[model samples]
Every structure is written in structure tokens, then in C-alpha cells.
Target: MTPGLRLRTAREGRGLTLERVARATRVNTRVLEAIEQDDVRAIPPRPYGRGIVRAYAAEVGLDSDAAVAEFFAQFAPVPEPVRPAPPAAPRPVRFRPAIDRRWATVMIVVIIAVAAATVVIAVGRRVLERRSEPPAVATTGVSAPTPAATVGTAAPSATPAPPPSSGVIVVLEATRPAWVAASVDGRRALYRTLKAGEREQLKGTDAVRVRVGDAGAVRWQVNGRPPQAMGRSGEVRTAIVTPSTAGSTN
Candidate 1:
């Protein structure tokens, strides 16, 4: 039987009313009903929801640990390992061409000068030959080749990246002051107050769950997923998180 059914069976065996348990445990009557009905979506998510089951089990004299375990068994299997974001592609290199313009202009002027000199020399030689003087023997030798200039430009630089987390990564960015409790793979990670603009990262290889004292005060994300507002300001909420589920307060 499912954890919810188990809880309901245990509660019925004890002849406890949902109202009686709610008053005893200080839990919501609706929540107690949801738990007995196997309506996980109605309860918070695992981990946090597991705590509710523990409290309920204790009130009804059941095995809290086993009930909590059964609640978490519904989640996906433990994650393998954390995966890092892919490296950014290298930036393209482009020459400005501005610095080489002066050199190009100078080369053009020298070519013009060389051509003019050659034409003048040829005319002079023809005139001397016409005057009955032996034509000056033309000397032919290759001019040295120009060396290629190298431009020294560095590749574009990138900013430092954030450190990698080794398990399912859950990020909580608090917009306003609030209380937050979180767990990963049933291991408690954080139970602290988060001031406005504060961020907390939690890790879970199996499953992660969180409870917010004030929903409107925080936004959350998992494994690089889009950030989601927890709820209206002052609303308390809970939800299960996995790499795939991304943990939604709704």
C-alpha cells in the first residue's frame, strides 16, 4: 500500500478523527485528509512532506521513520552525479586593418617610384643607342621579398564561472526576508533565515524538498532551470524537487 494509505490505515486503526489529529499535531485538517487520500499534490512535496507524515505517525503511534520512507519512495531514483554547464565557444578574432593602412600607402608610393625609374632608365638607354654608343648591358637581379608583418591580438576573455555542485542543485534566491528549510536525499541541508537577495544552494542525489515560511519572499530554481516565484507574499508552501521536476510551488 502507498504511504498515504498506510497513514490512513494506521489512523483508522487507532480510531482517530482527522479533526482530532489536526488539533493534536497542529496540522491542517485538509492536509490530514490529503495525506490519507494519497493526494501527494495536496500535501507539500517529499522531504518536507515526509516531516508531516512523521508528525502524523507519531501522533497516531505508528513508525514515523518507515512512514516517512514510504512517502519518499514515490520520488525518482537517486541522481548519478551533477553535470556542469558546457564551456562557452571561443570568440572570433578580427583584425582592425587600421594599423596597416599606413604601411600599405608607403608600399604603393615605392611601387610608383620604381616604375617611374625603370621607364626613365629605358628611355635613356634607347637615346644612347640611337647616338651610335653601344647599348648598356641591362642587369637583371631579383629584389628581396617583403616580410609579412604579424598582428598581436589576444582572444576575447570570459568571466569566471561559478563553482560546480556535486549533486542535484537547488538554488533559492530570497526576494524578501523569510524562513527556509530544505533537505536532499532525506539529508537536511539548510534550516535558516534568508534575508532579501540572499541565495542558498542545496544538493540532493535522490530527491530534494523545501518549505518556505513566506512564499512571496523567495524565487527558486533547480539544475539551471528557470526561476519560479514561490507564491504570493506571506504564503507558506512546500514542494518536492528533482533535476527534472524543477520544484514548483504551484
Candidate 2:
């Protein structure tokens, strides 16, 4: 008997209907019936068809591998058809704006003019600042006092020392660009960014408080004391100089 007949006979011997076999094997009832009736065209093609028959045979107590061999011996496998590939899409074109020669020339000239003006202003400002600053005092070398015209002339009495100035005197010198804000005696004194090599001196009766951005870029001194660094670079620091603390370094 054919493989399908053998499967159907085995299933019937076990009291299983086609519908019951279909449910157990997960195969459609119509396909199971077609297999039983030996209708090769009704089943799937080739390996798939053989696989379905194998499952059906195993579910009904027949040898699955042998069943597949026998079914394919009677109905050979059919090859899948080849399909043509779809065509590729076309690429898009990009457009750029047209440049005008007149506009380009005008822009170049404007940029040059602005740069020239900036340089001129910087040079002029430096010149004016130098003119406004106090000139350095020239000192002649020390010379021995002239011999007294007469032996009776006694050496001039020693010059007296100057009296101490009252009030706090704070000096800020910037080695680089730094933001500084200061107050003296509880009133605003100066609040601005100092350019490189700039110096400011402020006086206060009671106290002088100063705040700086870029701490290490600026050095400060109080009451003619030695200069001190505020902190490391890029650090923000504040200090209050009073008459009592001005002389002590801690």
C-alpha cells in the first residue's frame, strides 16, 4: 500500500479519525484526507510535503523517516521559481547660491576698515595712558658732602623721618585680565575688569574689601606691605584689609 494508505490504516486501527489525526499532528484536516487519498498535487511541494507526511505518519504510530522516503519516491519535489529584482531609485541634485562679486568686494573692504580702526584705537589709548602717567624721578648718584667752608660748620642734623599716614591703602596689580570689585569704608570704590599690567590704589579709613575673578592673575598689597597671591589660577577670592590686619601677614 502507499505511504498515505499505510498512515490512514494505522490511524484507523488506533481508532483515530482524519480530524483527530489532523488536530494531533497540527496538519489541516483536508490535507490529511488528501494524503490518505494519495493526491500528491493537493499536498505542498517537495521537502515541505515530505515533512508533513512524516509528521502525520509519526502521529499515527508509523516510522516517520521511512514514510517520508516512500512518499517522495512516488511524488518528486518541485523547485521554487526565481523572481526578478526591483530597480534602484535615482539620486537627487544639490544647488548652491550664486555669489555676487560686488558684494564680496564690499564685505572684504568693510572687514579691513574695522580691523584698522581697532588697531588705531588700541595704539592711541596706550599712547595717551603713557602720557598721563607720572614720570619716573631721576636720581643723581650720591656724592660726599662738600667739605665745610670753615672748620666751625658742624655736620647738618640728621633728617627727620616722615610721619605715618592714617587709613588703609590697598593696591591691586593685574598680570593678566581679571575682574575686580572693591569697596572702601563700606562704600563702593571700584568695580571693573583690569587689563593686563594695570594697577589700582584705593584708600579706606576703616577697611578695604576686594573681590577678584582669576585670583592668581592679580597680586595685592596693603599699607605698603609685600604683595600676596589671592589663590590658584581661575579661582575667585575675596579679602578685607583693615588697619589692624594690614601689617600682619598670615
Instruction: Identify the leading candidate in terms of lDDT.
Output: 2
Clashing pairs in 1: none
lDDT of the structure predicted as candidate 1 = 0.71
TM-score of each: 0.36, 0.34
Candidate 2's residue-wise lDDT over 1-250, tens digit each? 8877888899999998887886676556767788888888666544556767888988888899988888768865456844333323323334333345555556677667767777787687768744543343444656557665568777676566585466889889998776788888768988777888999999998677787756787888888888877777656667777665666632
Output candidate 2 Cα RMSD.
Answer: 37.4
- Show the colliding residue pairs in model 2: none
Q: For all candidates, what are the clash counts?
A: 0, 0
Q: For residue 91, give model 1's deviation from the true position in Å.
A: 24
Taken over the whole model, the C-alpha lDDT of each candidate is: 0.71, 0.73
